[model samples]
Target: MAKDNSRDTGKNTIPKKKGRQSAVCANPLYPCAMTGAASALAGISDMGVIIHGSSGCYYYADMAVPDTLHSTFIVQDEVIFGSAERLTEIVESVSKLYNKIAVINTCVPSVMGEDIKEILADYDTICVDAPGFIGYFDEGWRLAVRELADSIPINNSNSNTNTNTDAPLTDLSKDSKGNIRVNIDGVCSMDPFHKGSLIEATRLLNLCGLKTAAVFCHDTYESITHPSPYSVSVNPDYNCADVMNRRLNAGARNSTDSLLGPDNVLRTFEELSDRLTDTEDAEIDIDISKIESECEETDEILTKEGDRYLRRHDPPRVAVYSTYAYTEFACDMIANYMDGEIVHAAARNNPPDSDLNGGENPYNIGGICSLHRIKEILSKKDFNLIIGSSFEHAAFPDSAFVGLTFPIRHRKMLYDRPVAGIQGALYLMDEISETLENGNKKSN
Candidate 1:
């Protein structure tokens, strides 16, 4: 369990009462950073993940990852001597099953000062120091990527020449056939929406005649081992500084918005099209036209369903608590499909750079929200539709509840369904419309 980074500031002079709200699904008392780190590593197929800690730590992380994982179960005796021998055994076991391995450090082994790097230095391995107590889930995920980034081999001929120069290490474009293939970043299989997000991204990319080189951290180990000079980001939080499309960083519109709606699908094509400078202009337009036609059909279906929804039920006052992209997308669905308004929003990860919570922006409710502070805000609002984790759903039993975030016990779906892109927006709106109709509320 990670400690709350916030210290007990001066005590509030006035005490507040715990309101009569329904007991929402309770969050785990303590969230583990190790779980996030372990899950990230497990997403890569054929990559063996060794959780370096006690068996219990292995169990906890395995609950999230669920496959192709190794555990160094350092017993009490081994703790007294060292975990080196046990780790060696685990590595040997995993090496046979996997071509590459990642050593994820947990609290026990990390605290005990195990020589993990030294022991695995010669092997195809990267050691990510992701002790649970150090940070939160976001930090842990980024740390794992950073650690792997440090160890990833660049096969550029200019690698030696650039080593001593003042140039940045990440700029290996000289060796890259940039824009030939696309790498989709930030949709990890560990996320509740990972599978669906990846599927949608692949579909959208393929629609534009783009060949996917790799879906970073969500594909087989063989796929992720290689690097591309460019990638399209599904989430803004993922580090895109190295291989991201720089041409897309224009002042046309907010970058985050380009990850949410049908317009975003078009934007992605446009951006990637610019990078495909070698392609004939006529050919590029043809590809873009094909993708745009698909979105048009999607829009037609959604618009028809949305019209029926407006006729069937009153627009529910909605509030969303999730990532910025998820929140904004849900808001778009409601306003377009159900004619509803988002009364409030709480962003779980990085705060949005756009006008999500501004008065003019119908898509938002609050300025910025964290997991720690969102509960209080949700309790005070009068929203009838709540889109977020099980916790928020529990708080608003009377509201039209939809779970878009994680730890949702009631609905466990394995199918690929994106909350972004043309299909994603339509799917989410259909869910919202159906929930409203079935929840015994009618305008007629």
Candidate 2:
């Protein structure tokens, strides 16, 4: 976990703030709590998700989440009376199609004060009261994870035993082939790289002689509920294994290691290899050399590309705006590999005090969600390169840009591209180098 870099009294340290202030302003870049919950829950292939809110709320979430989503579509008539009938109608309809159903409450429906659990008492369903007014996307995602964890019956006697319920949940501690399984968390459907990240993480785990277990929000309901005790994350910011473990009262496992950057990927895999090797009583066996060798090759490629870029042009003075994890990774890559200067770094949401970066935030500001704030920062900072979403690109259309976060509208992504593994590191560097070189040429 990251330490408290906010307390550093260094001259270069940027002042830290608390919570998101964009709720008070307009044009907030991040999604609301309701959308976040929908994004997380909708990822389960066998779980049908219903957004219990207005049409606008339902539409926004439906568009943001790539997975299929149902909605109560409560109108003013339901609001005047109660949305119980509408919610139940949708839940009942969706129940027939899925093994499990999850309902995410939006701002209006949350304030309705109706007992959603009681309304759906006849059916086995999960209810998460994630109103948009409560907080941002991360909060809603956490709430859904907690609810999902609570629904599963923890069996201490035999971890592999099937539930007596009609839907038999599989124990994902090991696959049919007897390979050790590791859950992959932080696979929210809203993230553009979610699919690619899942594939990359699974590949890396397979390279270490392990198979993937549950993939947080992306797997089936049965698999998700019975994930392996151990887990890893592609995006640490949206990780839910810790929250799930806390809810399950399962003692902390050596999980939550992230594979966001080259250094992180190497360190995380190496640590996993050592732990698996040291467990004498366990049936696990892995070669650490494979992980080391792959990382060395990736590092060589990055070094060569980075050097090539530097030889052609001076390192870019860059500003990054994204989630805390991505911001940290981008800064580290640019500053260390490309020898660029981080003029400004801003996180769309307020990052947790501790994270995988060990609290070493290169951010000059945090909780930057407003368009006005982004424009203000861009106008003041003398950055030639911008690393963020389309919002940041629109804020300064002249600067060299790389789309690393959500809402990347300027370009089309036809392939499953990652921003989390060995390929991800190389992919990011490739974009940065090409974008910078092109921008320089256009200027000349």
TM-score (C-alpha, index-matched) for candidate 1: 0.77
How far residue 46's Cα lies from its native spot in candidate 2, in Å, is 0.7
Task: For candidate 2, write residues 196-280 as lDDT tens digits.
Answer: 9899999999888788877888888777766666788999888877666665544544277889887898898877766665654
Mind giving the per-residue lDDT tens digits that candidate 1 earns over 1-444? 453222111112111212111111123322356776777778777788988989898887776665567788878987898888888888888889887888889888888887789977767787888887765555577778766656555433443212222333223222353333556776755557766766777777677666665566777755554434445666555443242223222122112214456767777766655554433332222267877787778778888887877786677788776655677667777777677877776555433434423324454333232344445555776766677877665555566777787656556676666776676777777777777776733210
Q: What is the lDDT of residue 38 in candidate 2?
A: 88
Q: What is the TM-score of each candidate against the true structure?
A: 0.77, 0.90
Residue 41 alpha-carbon offset, candidate 1, angstroms: 1.8
Off-target runs (Cα >4 Å) in candidate 2 are 1-27, 161-173, 355-358, 440-444
Maximum-TM-score candidate: 2
In candidate 2, position 56 carries an lDDT of 96
Candidate 2: C-alpha RMSD after superposition:
5.3
